[model samples]
Target: MSAVLEKATFSKEAYKEAAGRLFHNEREQGYKPVGLHLYRLPTGPILYARVRMHKPAAEGVYEKLIRPFFHDGIEWKRGEPKQDNGKLLYGLADVQNLPQALVIVGEGEQKADELTKIGAGRLAGVTSGSASSASHADWSPLAGRHVLLWPDFDEPGSKYVDAIAAKLQVLGCALQRVDVAALDLPHKGDVMDWAERFRAAHDRTPTADDVLALPMTKAVPLDPPIGDPAEIDVWPAPQLLSAMTAPLDYPIESLPPRLRAAVEEVHRFVQAPLALVASTAVAALSLAIQAHVDVKRAERLTGPVGLFMLTIADSGERKSTCDTFFTRAIRDYEAEQAVDGKFVIDNYQADLAAWEANYNGVKEKIKSTAKAGKQSTTDLREELRDLEHDKPVQPKVPRLVYADVTPEALAFSLYKQWPSGGVVSAEAGIVFGSHGMGADSVMRNLATLNQLWDGNSLTIDRRTSDSYTVRGARLTVALQVQAATLRSFFDRSGALARGTGFLARFLIAWPQSTQGYRLFKDAPDDWPHLDAFNQRIADILRLPIPTDEGGNLVPVMLPLSPEAKDAWTKFHDEVEVSLRTGGELCDVRDVASKSADNAARLAALFHMFSGDTGPIAVDALENASSIAAWHLSESKRFFSELAVPEDVVHAGRLDAWLIEHCSATGAPSVSRRDAQRLGPVRKREPLAEALQVLEDLGRLRVEQMGKQITVNPALLEGVAL
Candidate 1:
């Protein structure tokens, strides 16, 4: 019993091979129904068998039945085992040509035998579980002097034979089809079913005439040629001999017109490769942006956070094809929908269409139906203005305020809403900041993105083409989440600007691939800040940190007093008027000079504080120290260190030098009084105060390129020489 079982199990490998053949051929067409199982092979080989689950049985039973042919050479693709009778599907092997030509045209072991009886070599059959378009290609190298194409006797079978015939013709083989008529003569079924039919007929000889006809298919006739396909790329060849057969003395300008045209054509063909080379180089370089990229004299900027939104969309398609696009769209849809829904609830309360349909009803109700009386939209909007959100005033919600925004600016439109859970949306709050309002949606999104970030760091075994690898985690989830998108956008295109503001503050880029270039086309936020975000990436990616003037930090002062704001606005207005009126009278050079002066004035204001000239001038000293360090002509290492803002330091050694020639009791220098600690003169005026401080300390804030300096007394406070 054991020997018989071993032999039977050893032979099962052919069946497993047939299953694998069916799998690879079929799975490519998408239906992958089979699992895997360890099965016995005909060579006493224990191997993985890809089986389709056709009947229900205990899971591990098939492995037990086929365990007898165990061996070591066969590799396994370890997968889930099929149950029941283990209807094998595909095999577990890297597809290759078998040693012997096991020409399998599938049915079962019996049908394969029938095929062998006629023209037997190593005849076999792989099941029709998958699309067999691959049979011709995969079997080509294996098709020795013998080749067969036997399929189920049907229309599909005929087409299969025809396809194989055309395909084999390329390999110098005439395909033969397996017709089933001869196999049916045995009994009621095919060649494999010949056992029952053998009992009906007195025929033991397995030489069936029609069985041989199965392996035959003629080549398809070619279409009559109109022109060769090569005509598309055809070019003229070299002329070995001229009409004279000897080298003619070619004239500088006397060549015949037809021959010249031919020569010109030849010249063009000759230069084509060179042109292609130059074109490719130009294309590669064009993607790199070239511009006058000095940011405020090359200062490293770390300003307020700038946000960018990119909507990756196809011009004509209904939806995007990016991975996880649907989920992204759903979020976008929900956000935009929330905005729209809020507008409706606040303004219409009831649907506009429904109201319009009942416009007569509203008017009718104004007289007969109920409370309040309003008709026109102007009045309707005003009436609903008070009823924006849920009433009865829920606690903790901040009241919103509104302002009319135009195409150029973000509208500061605010309204009051009861608590939607103490949500203090900066956008919905009273400070709907200038054009800065639109970034609110993306901001709220980012504040929540940290939750989705997984803390894994991936260590790649091999280097791939992709540059940014997110530790061990996938950026896909982060990208799909709220903040990753905006973060990526700003990091990409923030360097590009329309004037100073980014186009994205007004528009969005493509959502999925808003990487480097895609983010740049148009931006609407703070372009400098957008560009600044990329500096953070240099550290993360281990590349050199890109410095703008070596990371210059710009400190902008805000107006603490209403008067300063008013003064600023007026000054700005006057500057604008001066430029517009004076510009017309001057030549282009004169106009440019005036513009430069205006720019200087604006820069001054941009760096000013509301504390009059005192603090602004003192702060100006710190600025001058930094400015001097950045230049080629006035670079100073010690002065550069003065830019560092700190709490406290040394003083005794510097103090001794300040009060030289002073007597201990009531001491007075030749020109000044000596005190234990004498602070610099507070000149009250901006420039004077600035200079006195700088004289005592080591740095000064020079306003214009070569103007008077604003100095800080604090730098000299605790300094030791």
Candidate 2:
């Protein structure tokens, strides 16, 4: 379609030498010597030639093509208009010129010319590009014409045949494919190979009549014939299910040294679950310090360092032990505060009573003096004003953590306390199966959590008198649920969670169970890591909490160092790439899209936890990026499992059952009737549906002749299930 086709001219002999005998013969017929450059050696001499061909439908419409030499291992290249060459066919002008000719369609320009010389009417090369590109070719030129297709004998050739056949059937052409397998040919052999073998045996090229006489198969249309639908097999196309596997390993090394050492010690006792719970506890600790720390990504983009984390593992994984070990300092601090808070609360109460008594006495005196019509009641009124001005203020207790509370109550605590709170628990059902997570309140709870994660205010308006607003609140939450419970959460809230961006805001981990591996081990004489870990947490708790002029808690911004900012920017940009179409996060883009923001928050948290009150360092951001990378991988795996269609999941379950129940010998077949009677599947419709899916997936095949299902032998190859 360009004004002029651009090509590097090469020597005729050079073209013949590079392209070999097949192309040499084709060149003699009509192939021209136009060349292209090879990859990597851009300045080198031309490596191949472009074969110009005209469109059958129009004149002066030629497609640019490049056929490279195999010696150089260079793939065929195309010019600008060649990405989707659907409208153009090779040798199209020749085929269009021949009316009522029995067109022999094959792959390559050389083969088409070979067939053309053998008296095959209007020989046409399929410019559909490649085996994978077959479906994109223009098959309309052969519409209503009798066409014979000779696909190369290979797996890709079979796909090539299927693609062309599907298009031909739609175009309503008279079609048949040469059964290359029936004829003895080499692996990945072609139509020319068959002809050459015949020539070698008979001392002459095979004619059109002889080639037509060979066994051929008719094309099968995708749609069933208009008759009894029961006669046709109803198989749904198989969707590619994500590989069933555990989430990526938790990033224990990403933790700061003291924390990492402490996690390693705890992991010796509880294994990977310890790392998961510890990571979550760290996130909770970040939330407690959220009001006192923030990451300045840019002038317009400063964010809280809080994190919401969820860990999923089966019970008896010592999830509680891991939580208790990391959270001991927080609990001890809360206890200490409770002890100190009681006396302060009592003193304030007693002072409030005395102040009220004094104010009442002053007010009574002012009223009596006014009623008696006495001179100058201004002195008594000024005393009442003084009493009112001296009214006692209630003391605020510094409480840091919350457990098993509804979202409404959580918001109230945030408002009444330091505008910072955390929900820390080993049981996830408290969050997922709570009354607040019911149908009516699910969105409200999820929305509230999402706001808190963003460091935004939550306004809880209710018909009851307990309505309140929590402004500038920071919330950190961590929960560990069983796999079954997690699945239930997905079932109940997955769509809503994704729609409201609730799931995206949380860092999630689903670690492999390490139940049997744990053994009794004595601690080292100086296990200072655990002490240092708790001590660091206590130190963070004791940092003078930043507050506004009105005594309201405010976030203390923690800007990144120049080195950390540069590293974080690069990491953030890399994460942004995955959110694009066809990337790893394409399916779970809802969560994947938020990965970088989560990384930024994590980097700041890591810096603060490392005892750095200054700017965030490069090492801290690097470690946080490592942790974020793990979470992103786990999120992709987790969501892929969650995204598996209901029917596909049923098919997978049935697949496992079939693999389990099959007889030792490969001869046994299960009857559909008997399967319904004795199989793991109870419902006929769903069982039939699942079986149809498994058949489509090549896991098994069903035949009406036997009314039985035979599992594919390949399904048992090197696999127990």
Candidate 3:
């Protein structure tokens, strides 16, 4: 023999590629090789390989490779290595020696070695002997640390990760899923494949920094359930549109013939968006009749005859113009009434002075008689009683509308002008940002408005002003404001309004802007359609205002017809169904809660405007239901965006930029360097922070191959450029 060598060895470099390939293969197959060895007979060639295991090996290439052999003319066979009772995770010891090291768990020994190589010892790479044996491994070593799991892209591997995930969760390890799919890997690809692809494209392998930068999605805890199956329902993540650029479209056809024609004519005349003009028209109509009309839902139930409406739009959207156009009739009517009221006010003042003088004389005689110790005359006492009973009834002013007034002032006006009135404004700041709507007065103000919306009598007992009560009155409200101001309102007073039912009373609209398309077109002299619209408004306004014998307003009660009632009942039931568990409106239950009442009110308003004296019709109810559906859809979109977290909002902006710039160019990913430099987010730190948050949420990935940062592929799905 050349030598009686006691050991056989090979240079590590000779099998490096093979080892790398083996690592990747094991990872793909859901097996963790751990520490594998190529054994050999002393003084000879290779004998068999042994892979570290938590259980005895069954059958594989390692088992097949073992066979009897003759060494130096002596009979030999595969040798059985002694099992160690206190085995450790492959690279745990090395990792433990490093201060503040991050650890990654992969499937195979080669994968762990590759991770160690890539991380340059800063990463502790370990694996359980095999996928099936993952639960048997000593995971206690990784406890109290943030651990990342790199599972192969296959069913078996996913199952393995899931199994270990439950154990890891119980062991108190924080886990993240490093998704390679975002890297655009081939089907059944692993980390090795990703690295190889990166190396092939960039002429260098990905380093630990690259792996560390990959986006991570939170690993949902696999906590075992402890409840009946029927009682447990898993909630999947809700799918939402990436953005909402337009409001839900209202059903114009649902309007009655004249109203529909008026809306169309105004839309043509103004050359403004139909949504804006149509909404304003509805507001004007409500102002016309809400004070005099009421809907009798049941014998005991009555809805506020008026509507509370809010329209949101960007600046330069002709909001002011629409308000002026639709509400012109109300303004003209109020002007005429103002002119007529002066004479009545003067007469009332004289009459009140005379009554007071007469009453004082009677009171004086009674007091003198009582002081003289004589019985008061029956006629004098009766005169005093009559004076008190006929105390000059204050003339109810014909004020149909008020704007930019405080809550207290509005209440007083309503008390003075019985039956109905409205608060109308083109700017939301007149309402939401008014001094009366400040934090201190928010609750009191909203409570007043809420009660007004419910057709309940209101009492405003202000310490600084005269106390007053509004009885049997209806209040309509309509305002148009920029979207941002509305959001600010939501931040400040929306919660309280919702809780107090003030916000629920509004039928909100967020319409698209019609800024660029407003061509200058003159209307024919005295357009009859315009005249007809205004005339209809005038007719409604001229309807006699009703009051009880006590001078309190009385509403003309309108009942829903039998068929209409059935339809409304069915609609209410449907809405109730949506407010239940697992329903679409669950997130928007506050708005949904009042939708039926709003619908009924709309039905009544529609019936009145349609010039129908009979009970509310099925057609009217159906039309109102359609409008309610649109409002509900719009509210869902608006409220969802309103609730987006600040950080996620930034991410959304970035997402929009990515879709427009990168995704549209057939390149779904971006270099972080490019993103920071050329991204819509101008500042470096904010962009980085936003990217980090997005990565955590699995919306995007930030990676580093070398000095350059790389964003992953398809960062935004279903988003248009």
Candidate 4:
């Protein structure tokens, strides 16, 4: 005997007891009682057995129970298995021989078995375990086949069929819905019920022709109903992208003591979004300390401590105020340095003038000696070479902040003027909308910034101007702009911004506006926290910048402690899993790929800014990981929103409106005319486009009957129609 038969034995006494408890009139029911049923693979080996009862042991309990079995080479070994890809639909093997035949999907295994017996060679039948299991089962066998959904006469059954339809649609199946209402069956009826009624009236079992003759409606195709199909065919529905709700608030507690106090104080004084204040303050801190150290994440992985932050908000939100407040100390340090270096500047000018005069005199002597053909011109050439070598070198001044500058100009400044600086702007239009980001210069400038972010050397080769190479340079870019301007930038840049990973390097925040809730109050009596914060910034700025003799930044390397390294490794592996094909972060893989690195950089900044000594600690890495994870989620939300077409966004809005409207009024659908006048999208053309998008997504169906719009059963699964 097979292993299945050897393990499972028929229970005659249990069958008798179940029949007595379940059926009242066994003789008149006209069907023999069978207690044991085997669930097998399509190739004919039993996988498991289910013992059936005529009714449940108690109300609200299952009528069938599964018997455990051992299965080698599968995730499921014994007991109830998970309803995943390992579990195939019943009757799947029977349809493999008939590749082009029609398949009927029903609710349970019993119903599927009856249909398969009656289908003979004409059709096949299958069920994904139960109504709710449709999403979990492997549906690849039904790909490219004709599928007819025969749901029960109730709402849950309808939802089950719709769920199956969704999977089948993705598999490229030709779909149709069987109209159970036309059969005039009672509530919660099934095909088995109809067969029993037929036996009562005609004294015989119903044939396959009787069930095939039932009514059904074909699903609408991908083409829109009215326009030329080619017009909309070019735009297919996006894969694995969905609308997201607002992200959680920024984790203010993650910052160190001094930084947290400053952020809280600024938020109180400015009454802006807490996130805006925190992000600006973090960027300013990065600017002050990035040139001092490089964070070592692993043996071979080391990167700069610089950060690129972008904040999106509307006008009148105090973005400028927040930026000015955080950067006040850096600006003050620049002014103080310029005042203290006046004498040095004057001496350099005098030295440069004297050197220029000596260089010209030597060139004249060389020319005259060559013209006279005297002394072979060797001594004069040597004098000119020495003069060239002793040219006056300009002093390095402290000019660390810039705004409204082109990328080329920024590169030049970093190369020739200073090795570390920032481009801080409240109105980001001066940066994103400037000529530097125009069609011709956008790519080159983006690459330049990306190179700086990675701490790699940048070589700027200019044809009409001076050529310079920037090594070990660091930059912190913090910008706040309105949403409309950012969207316009995305439109102009096409795919270059995200395609080249320029935007991926940025930590973005799009916080909800806190406008009307700002009820003004008197300022605090003493600004002790803000005062201390400014003092720390000034002290860090006054520290000597680590640099080589060639004027290139050479920063101290900060390694992670053993515990910190273990924590970071776990975080990195978790993010890596989410970058797989169907994971949540799959669409935004670029941003997720860099999140761990950013976490390490943030940890270094916290370590240096808090005046901590030695290696990075576990607490610092934990705090930084929390903040970095929040920004990663924000990236997923905004990037997905930015990539969606305008019409599809409108469709998402309409979908919400429909759900509310249908649930409030207890209606299955709304008329097109009413939707036009009373919907979220009022204009006719836009509404039409939005509706077509919804239809293509299987969220709703448009019927010619009064041009009515009926939502898919899956949308309002539990609610009454």
**Which of the numbered candidates is closest to the native, going by highest lDDT?**
4
Q: Identify the superior model by lDDT, candidate 1 or candidate 2.
A: 2
lDDT of 2 at 87: 28
lDDT of 1 at 712: 25
lDDT, each prediction: 0.28, 0.67, 0.68, 0.77
- Candidate 3 residue lDDT tens string, 1-721: 1232123234334333334443343444455444454433322343223444222256543311111111111111122222122123556654566547677787655577788778886676766534444543456767777778888777645656665566577677788878756778767677677778878998987787888899777775544522223532211111112332224356788877787888888788787667678888888888898867788776687766688888776566676787787788888998988889889989999999999999999989988888897775788899899899998877876787777898777888778754578888877787888879887889998888888888788977778767777888778898887666776777777578777777777888876545544779887566566567788889988888787886777878899999998998888889888887756677778888888888888899888877888899998998999888778877776776677754555566565566556645656566776666555455676777767666654445555552233333222222222
Worst 10 residues of 2 by lDDT: 71-80
Task: Compare candidates 3 and 4 on lDDT and give the better one.
Answer: 4
lDDT of 2 by residue, 38-97 (tens): 211123333334343222334754333343331222111112122122324545555666
Per-prediction TM-score: 0.24, 0.57, 0.57, 0.60
Candidate 2 vs candidate 3: the lDDT winner is: 3
Q: lDDT order of candidates, best first?
A: 4, 3, 2, 1
Residue 543's lDDT in candidate 1:
22
Top-TM-score candidate index? 4
TM-score of decoy 1 = 0.24
The order by descending TM-score is 4, 3, 2, 1
Runs in model 3 with CA error above 4 Å?
1-246, 356-386, 462-467, 517-519, 523-526, 645-721
lDDT of 1 at 494: 38
**Candidate 1: C-alpha RMSD after superposition:** 39.1
TM-score of candidate 3 on Cα atoms, chains taken together? 0.57
